[model samples]
Target: MLAKVLEEPERGEFFARREDEAHSLVNLLQAILDYASLSPSLKRRFTSALIRLSSKSGRFPDCMVLEEVTRLGEDPVAAGSFGEVWKGSFYSEVIAMKVLKVYERSNVKELLKRFSAEIIIWRQLSHPNLIPFYGVYYLNASKTRICLISPWMQNGNVVQYLRREPDIERSYLMLDIARGLEYLHSGKPGIVHGDLKGENILITSSRRACLTDFGLASARDSELIMSSSTPNARVTGTLRWQAPELLNYEAENTRSTFASDVYSFGCVGYEIYSGEIPFHEVKSDYYVMQSVTRGARPPRPPLSLCQTRGLDDTLWAILQSCWLKDAAARPTAEYLVSRLRAMPRNAEEKTTPAAHGWDRLTRSRLSHSLVDHPLSCSAKVVQEWKQLSLFEDWEA
Candidate 1:
């Protein structure tokens, strides 16, 4: 029976068609193993073939598996286009597990490819400003659900952390973000963070901003952005933070260049300074796309807005230069960091909390009103409750 199963032309043909189909014959082989007491040599041959087939099948190595991980709760700490992030504990360490959403069998193959690609890229990156990746594993026995594990940022995403600790300096946050980008763009074949925005930036317990989510990242040499023929090259990042050239959809602009990242960095600056997303007033992403393609930008925050935030005019000027219609005119990430470093620090910033008194008052009132409420309170409020001394640590 084992010989017949192995010798079947149709079985061999099916397995040869795609590596993904190799597992289809596993059940048949298992049944044969139970019925026929195979000889040691035959068993060895079968084991060797199974090992070769496993490697070709794209299963992550055994080292990547988490023998046990305890989910904290049903609520996800964060959510994104690809998955929801839950806080979990593995080997006594708290980690964030991003569970990819389920898809039809037809699309599962492509999703798995993407998940594997993300892991490969993330594992190779090691930097202080880049979020640390732990590993990835299958969530269940069936192996249909995959989860990416990474260190949990206690402070959460940049925007959320900022809203909570309004006293933190915007320049410091911006500087951290710039440094992360500088690292990504400085390597031999620099990496392009295709999707960069406030949400993608996380704040570590040390109050440092770290970059994460490399699902769309690509090596400069690979030039995933350079080829317009590829669907991913054309549309992958958030429209609000995307460079005008990227929005133009021109064959040349379709290539994601470091210049495009600089443009998105500018939008991040706008978010940090104004406390609002780029084009927050705009009703639709389509409108923002149209406006950007025409050389229109999010209206500059008034000088008063900058002053109120304790931000120098030079920083605002840098943002303007970043949004220059010509991609070549935009300053490189390295230049932006240097310019930001040269800006003078505010005297009041040393003593004053970064947030205005009114903003503090408003938040305090909201917190008080929601103190007794459970479901009515937002995730941020719940987080605040959990970390009662969070503000004290920030002040320290």
Candidate 2:
């Protein structure tokens, strides 16, 4: 089947099939099964072949990421106090390598515990959208370096994706991400992402996104989340997507509960619709938190626009529910996915003014990006997905 796909120049990259890919995969046998009926053994062979293909992505002492890794350096992407990230590869698969540098305050033992925990936790997580961990290595010395390997996305990150084209039907793509979240929330201990924002979400060659950088997923052991000693530490998350509860930094953020992630997802939803950072119009995280805490809801995606386009309100409601200030309020990611899938696909309006209901949010750059598209509206979902800043445009 893959050979057949290779026959077509467009589908030649058979190994790049992403479970959440925006486009159809023609090459793999399982993909063929998805396209047409096939025998079970054929599927087995396909899986075996893919494993071999995937294995080749990372292996060797002098791999690209390994060679490029340094004791102390600038972040290949960008830097925050959390850690310094680098772009690297394993086998041949591109990976975003992260190395947290040590400091005077760095507790070698505690730091190691947390860093090791990050890798160990990811080792057990496997989902289409939850980025997988290939391996980890440390340099010997007081330098105290910890490197984690994750699948690299040709595109940069989710925030950049929205900046270029915000009107795409990314809600479906979010469904895939939700599955990963559901898996995490359904685990034995039920992992808490601690941090969930656009920068941590990455896009694959196929334009499907995977959640990465789990350097802070530890769950809280707090009896009263609002009773933390250090209120300032709670502000560690990205300000743009700050959840209301994250404002107190210490006291209010006492518990890194599942609800906190939901709150973050709500802010992400806002980013998706507005094509701008959450609270970009705001002065500070504290101010944004005030609005969210007081139910200062970000304007909803225009119902007229949504209705005109036949967008799913149920799904939109699910996205909005994540914004609830009470950390105990949001639905589980699994439940949200279920509701989204059950939604009718009848609301696909083909023609309409781009500036109907979401006039304030949808403007020149965003609407213009979609106006000239030559593919199906669904095609635009991915058509523009690749065009987004995170990944190189694939139209060529």
lDDT of each: 0.65, 0.52
Predicted structure 2, TM vs. truth? 0.60
Per-residue lDDT over 1-396 for candidate 1, one digit per residue giving the tens place of the 0 to 100 score: 334333332344423523423333332332233344777545433433332233234432333345456678879877878889999876556778999887775665667555554564565566767886666666777778888877777888888988998777778778778878998888644677878899999887767788898777765533211222123744878889999888876554466678988999999888887889999999899999999998888777888877777657677788889899999999998998787666666333335332211112322233232212322223443244235432222210
TM-scores of the models, in the order given: 0.70, 0.60
| lDDT (tens digit, per residue) of candidate 2 on 1-396 | 233322232332443434333122212222332243535444333333322222222111111113332332344676667676777644334455676766654554456444544554565566666776655545554536667655556566876765554565676556556766777777643566767877788765555667777766642222211121222334565655656666654563254567777777776666565555665668776677677767776666567766543446665677678877666767877777676556655133213111211112222222232312222233444444454432243332
Candidate 1 weakest lDDT stretch, 10 residues: 354-363
> Which runs of model 2 end up more than 4 angstroms from their true locations?
1-75, 104-107, 139-143, 164-168, 219-235, 239-242, 248-253, 301-312, 345-396
Instruction: Report each candidate's C-alpha RMSD, comma-separated, in the order given.
Output: 17.5, 17.9
Cα lDDT of candidate 1 equals 0.65
Error of 2 at 331 (Å): 1.7
Backbone clash count for every predicted candidate, in the order shown: 4, 13
Best by TM-score: 1
Which ranges in model 1 have alpha carbons more than 4 Å from their true place? Answer: 1-63, 222-233, 250-253, 346-396
